[model samples]
Target: MRTSFIKKKKNASTDVALQITSMADIFMILLVFLLKNYATSVTNIAPTAHLSLPEVNKSKGVIKETLKVEIANDLVMIDQKPALALHAFQFDPSEDGPGGVSPTVARVLNEQRKLRPEPNMDSSLLVMADQQTPYSTIKRVVASAASAGFVDLQLVVVQGE
Candidate 1:
């Protein structure tokens, strides 16, 4: 009788060896549900302290799929990295002894272009400028981007709160 009881216990333990297929099924269902509800078409790029975009009423939504250059009052940033510092809204590129286009900006733009497949300077650029930024300063940044071959520039602005 004892031997029969031991045999029954062993059989029960074997039957209880964790049912993993059910757990796997649950995970698969959850993954499918999440994928179906995921939002993939829109890309959102938020502004930072160094780049405070002006508020505009009739502008389109933000485009974050392309390369970005941010021009601040005292700094220029590309890809969120500080590419150069300005002295009173002026930067002398170390590459070209003082007084041409901001060399640092030009060089960084060229480098950024290399990441694209097109050999020509045809990368789309987004310029995020502050409200207090001067028009002349904005022109210099646009010119530098154009020289680097990025003609498709979309100015970044915020919606009125």
Candidate 2:
């Protein structure tokens, strides 16, 4: 009887082992997928020496997709690319088109508008101008942007404590 019981136990086949290697492979693939798709939410704001932004007590946070225009002492940049150059912080009258709009600025802004997801809905620009920049130059830039279908404008300034 004892020999029969041992044979029955041997035939039961109770030596099953869990397959962990496949599970581990699945977890590694998931980790890699997550890492590949991860995107940072932080926005970067860089300050340059050529532009001196005015100080304000309160200001709103900048949107990541907003078009940025920087006016320095000697140059005007769109999205950090030089769009126009100024002589002694002044623009030439010939640079202005009909209705006092800058043709260079208008062309660039139009190109940017087409790249937007909703161009009409995002008709806004963030302008950072030097403190010493003349108001006339700023106005011309604004006019050019407006002509390119960007009507909502926000001036970027240094946030004060």
Candidate 3:
């Protein structure tokens, strides 16, 4: 008996490609969500030195229509306006017992608080100070605001880049 050899044939075909439309749709949804959550009225304060703020576990969101106090190296601003010039403070060691916040800061805060619709309501005051700023300076500013009847104080910090 004679045996014969046979050759096998291969199928020429390609697998189905994956569709990326679903992924694009998901990304679009995520973009919309992030855009909706973006803050519109953010108060930006440029500090003279990098400051690492003491953190708290609690989360405090922004309060609408609040006062802002910016403390720079040699000047202080209220609501982004120059309320007190550099020479406004008495740097003389003999005259001024200790460095103090400008009286105008307290007065302005008081006036703004009065103008607020809900004076009795709990309103927040945001304080932005440079990192190199001495603790005494921070305390003085906070004390002035407190004396002006600002109970809720929020120290502003950069959350992330």
Candidate 4:
């Protein structure tokens, strides 16, 4: 009996079939994580030094029911109420009268404090002024608040654009 030898044939093609389900799952997980983190990390913007601020030794943080004062040209709003209506003044260090901030801020703060005086009141005065508002105005507001027995003063500003 004679035995015949046979040759083994090699497979011609070799290509990988990609499974996209795992890749899609990973992308979805990353997207969800990023979205969740972004939702939790929201923050407000604050202004820079292009705007001037007064020098105060004890600048403190803000608390609830803060007395917000807004100083704009020809307008002075106290706690979102129109407190004073006067012409806007320039930043003049040599001015004899009250500087940038309205002179009545102190009195207003004092009155508010008197009306709602509680032990260890942490309420603060929040000053929001325009960028163009002069340093004198800021100084005046700060001075008024300080004079009104508001040791805690917070300067509100917009964050970087």
For all predicted structures, in order, the TM-scores are 0.63, 0.67, 0.55, 0.50
Residue pairs whose backbone atoms clash in candidate 2:
none
Candidate 2, 1-161: lDDT as tens digits: 44654444446777889999999999999988877766443244454438778988877766455888888888888877888888877887779698889898899989988988897788888887888888888888989999999888778777798
Candidate 4, residue 85: the lDDT equals: 55
- lDDT at 40 for candidate 1? 51
Residue 50 CA error for candidate 4 (Å)? 20
In order of TM-score, best first, we have 2, 1, 3, 4
Higher-lDDT candidate of 1 and 2? 2
Question: 1 or 3, which is superior by TM-score?
Answer: 1
C-alpha lDDT of candidate 2 relative to the true structure: 0.81
Candidate 4 total steric clashes: 7
Give per-residue CA lDDT, model 3, range 1-161, as digits (tens).
65646655667667878899999999999998877766553425444333344444554655445677777666777776666543322222322223364466677778877877787774678787765577766676776687678878877765543
Lowest-scoring 10 consecutive residues by lDDT in candidate 1? 5-14
Which residue pairs show backbone clashes in model 1?
A: 121-149
Q: In model 4, which regions exceed 4 Å deviation?
A: 1-65, 90-103, 117-120
Report the number of the highest-lDDT candidate: 2
Model 2 bad stretches (over 4 Å)? 1-43, 60-64
Q: How many steric clashes between backbone atoms does each model show?
A: 1, 0, 0, 7
Measure candidate 4: CA RMSD: 9.9
Q: Give candidate 4's error at residue 132 in angstroms.
A: 0.6
Worst 10 residues of 4 by lDDT: 42-51
How well does candidate 2 score on lDDT at residue 104? 88
Instruction: Kindly report which residue pairs in candidate 4 clash with one another.
Output: 45-159, 46-158, 46-159, 47-158, 100-136, 100-137, 101-137
